[model samples]
Target: MYVLIPAYEPDMRMIALIESLKETNPQPGIIIVDDGSGACYEELFQTASRMGCIVLTHETNRGKGCALKTGFSYLKGIGASGEVVCADSDGQHLPKDIMRVGSCVEPDSRSMVLGGRRFSGKVPLRSRFGNSATRFVYARSTGVKIHDTQTGLRGYSTDMLDFLLEVPGERFEYEMNVLLTAAKYGYAIKEITIDTVYLNNNESSHFRPIADSASVYLPFLKFSGSSLISGAVDFVLVLLLHSLSSSLILAVWGVRCISALLNYTLNRNVVFFKESGIRHRTAFPRYALLAVLIACLNYLLLFLLYKKAGIPLPLAKILTEIPLFLLSYWSQKSFIFTLLNPNG
Candidate 1:
């Protein structure tokens, strides 16, 4: 196994972390991709080298994502291949936690293992909310109930490293993007809960609250935006069809069918462009089945609320719309979109 750490003028805690890693049994090969921490840190790299660690420098700061790519490529180039674990330089992650991640890595299986952080104890307020919000949105968009998507404490098989070359984003957002892309490729992702310790409350962290959060949450926003457009289209078409036909039920089904097709088309082609390989022929039938399932559920709820319960029609519509929209989004992102292109 190989351990890769991307450091940028790392503090003394990094040295302690490296030392701890060296003391572990079945000593793993370690690689530190220094993102241009200049002459001041030359001695630190040299010390690590004397301890038989591979020290690769980036001359200039290229961001964490770039440093990771360099390290993975280097690891592959040298034939020291197997599973690779990525740890943060800030020393928030424990070296022993690698064992938890290691236990989940199957020799022949292609999966990404992530260390789930337990936020039950003394965690900062912002950190807690940020992680929780992101997790909820991510679960809705990807259908993967991962506890922590932002943790750098993760393990990936060498074969999965191929994605390193294709992954975009240069900073914090890169890791989040990789998880999404990995899911798109049919890779199994599992989460293992571990201790959460903020070495310095991440005060010196490079992550920006609003700006970086936007990058990390981009996919969720895109999904929400797409759903909004599709919902509007669905409602408008339904109203138009109702006006065209005397039978309100006929208009409802017709509008739903048309809007579903439109939503699927836009989501597959635009939102998740690289993963739209469900063979147009096979996709429609499966999508139609899913659409019908949603319609039935929607109709049942609408009827129960508006007629039986005697709620105003508009209020009942709004009540039913919320749950319906959520169910449809999750089903589409996880099952429909995923099946459409199983081998992306």
Candidate 2:
């Protein structure tokens, strides 16, 4: 096994972490990628080297992704072909959890082991909500049912290293990008709960809420945009049908029904795009149920807006269905085209 730590301006706590790992029953190769924490922290690197661990140095401060890439290159350079466990410099990860994840790694390890954080018992409200939202987005985008999407402590087999290295984000978002890419490449990612230790309640976190969220959510937002196009199609069809036949309220519903089916089909094939091979069996029925739910809610809201609010029927149909559009996106992501199919 190989242990990789990406450190940036780490303190004495990190030395303690290294010492703990060194004392493990069956020790593993340790590689520290110093992301240009420079002369001040060279003593730790020197100590790590003296302890028979490889210390790979970066001249400048590169983001976490670059540090990880550097670590993979170092692993390849040393001819080490085993599982690599990446833990943070901040000492939030416990050594036992690393070993637990390591135990799951086989000779030809092909899966990624994520150290899932069980954030229970009065975890900070903002932290809990933030993680929950990101987890949902990641699960929807990648079809990986992970509880913690941003956990830095993870184990990836040697074969999976190249995939992680090629991922595109520079910082924390790189983790999310890798998750999506792993799903794209058909890699199996399993999550196991690990002890939670918040060194500073995330005081050292480098996350910029808005900017990082934009990076993380860019794909989902694009998916939502696609759903919007579908919504527009459904809306236009409902309006057109209402105009052609005044008595055919059922006809308007039928047009929306057809349009929703088209929207769901395209979104399933192109937007969420998971290959469950369930099109013939579960896909249509599940989608039909979702469409019916969305249509009923949309109609009720449109009726209320048009009759009670005294708005034009066509205009009300457009206005009231906006919320329903968002609802359908979430519904479809969570239920409709998800990887819950047994085959997937």
State which candidate has the highest TM-score. Answer: 1
Error of model 1, residue 272, in angstroms = 2.7
Estimate, for each residue in 1-344, the C-alpha lDDT of model 2 and write its tens digit. 88899888788777788888888744788888888898999998888788777888889988888888889877776677878899987788899999888777765655688899989765655567778888887765545688888788888888666566666777767887777666655668888999887766766666555676677786567667777776678668777777787657766668766776677667777776643344646667887887778767877888788888899987997787676766666566555665552223
Q: Could you tell me how far off, in angstroms, the CA of residue 243 lies in candidate 1 after the best superposition?
A: 5.3
Off by over 4 Å in 1: 38-40, 163-169, 181-186, 233-270, 274-292, 307-312, 335-344
Give the number of the best model, judged by lDDT. Answer: 1
Instruction: Report the poorest 10 consecutive residues by lDDT, candidate 1.
Output: 335-344
TM-score result, candidate 2? 0.68
TM-score, cand. 1: 0.80
lDDT of 1 by residue, 21-76 (tens): 88884478888899998999888888877777899999899888889999988977
Residue 194 of model 1, lDDT score = 76
Worst 10 residues of 2 by lDDT: 335-344
Predicted structure 2: clash tally: 0
